[model samples]
Target: MNSNWFKLLMKATRVQYGENLKLNGVPVVFNKQGAELLIGDNVTINSSFLSNLVGLYQRTIIVTRTHDSKIAIGNNVGISGATIYARTSITIGENTLIGGNSKIMDNDFHPIEVEARNTDIKEKIAARPIVIGKNCFIGCNSLILKGTILGEGCVVGAGAVVSGVFEDNCVIAGNPAKVIKRL
Candidate 1:
């Protein structure tokens, strides 16, 4: 609940924000300047949640590594200790609540090939966009990977590793994250 860290973060990042954007604590990191980070109105970030004694170390991280990469968070979205790394685009719809330690990414960040792995080259073709629909709930420790799309009102269970598309008004769970129930 300190103002000092938030002030420092505000000075550090090139974030283009709308009204009433709140930060509970410092984000772990925000890298790449040419990339865009757009946060909508009434978005709240609480990176200190569920950190136990390591609350100060735990933080929400948003990174866009290239000029074409972007991260967009819609209105009334509340996230805690979430890491959103975008090589392409990652968009979260309005009224969504993302729990502590969740991760959403739109790219692999590296090539699988042994020769390419050691090089500094990136696989731009492998990256895709991640879209989470309105009024969704992403539980703690959930991992939403590249090309994943969740329709409106979907709920992702804690510790779920989600990939692919999920229909609206459903409950998604498990490692690969399947529709557990249709709400």
Candidate 2:
């Protein structure tokens, strides 16, 4: 669609996309009901990964995880082919760039403890918030787990799995994405 037509269509549909936001690709699909999705200004989405996110939604998988969550993105962010599910909250700060085929999660659907994982039912599941701060760049095929925090001006390398609180202005890489160097 043309720029003007797209704007009009989005407005008419009541999709709360912010100003100067360009959506180049399709969404991954809404997995569960009451999942709040919020985006900010001047952003771009470049790829599609519907299959990767299918398990998170009730509509796709037969034995699906409960996913009434919220995702919040700040201004001037660009993302490509990422599968994200926010059980509580996954907040991305301003001026952040997320690489292709990444995964961000704030919950562990299955119980991790011996009793919880084995048993059919558990009192509570584990979930932790993820925060990516301003001016950060995440590399391709990275996996960011619950309670993961990336500070300002941080850069994550390709094919990495990041968890826990992280400092700012550093280059991190690897399976368990570590700090390779400071930026």
Best by lDDT: 1
Clashes of each: 0, 1
78-182, model 1: which lDDT tens digit per residue? 888888999889999999998878889888877767677777467633688999999999988899999999999999998999999998999999987899999
Estimate the TM-score for candidate 1.
0.88
lDDT of 2 at 6: 54
TM-score of each: 0.88, 0.75
Which pairs of residues clash in candidate 1, taking residues 3 or more apart in a chain or in different chains?
A: none
Worst 10 residues of 1 by lDDT: 49-58
Q: Rate the local accuracy (lDDT) of all candidates.
A: 0.83, 0.70
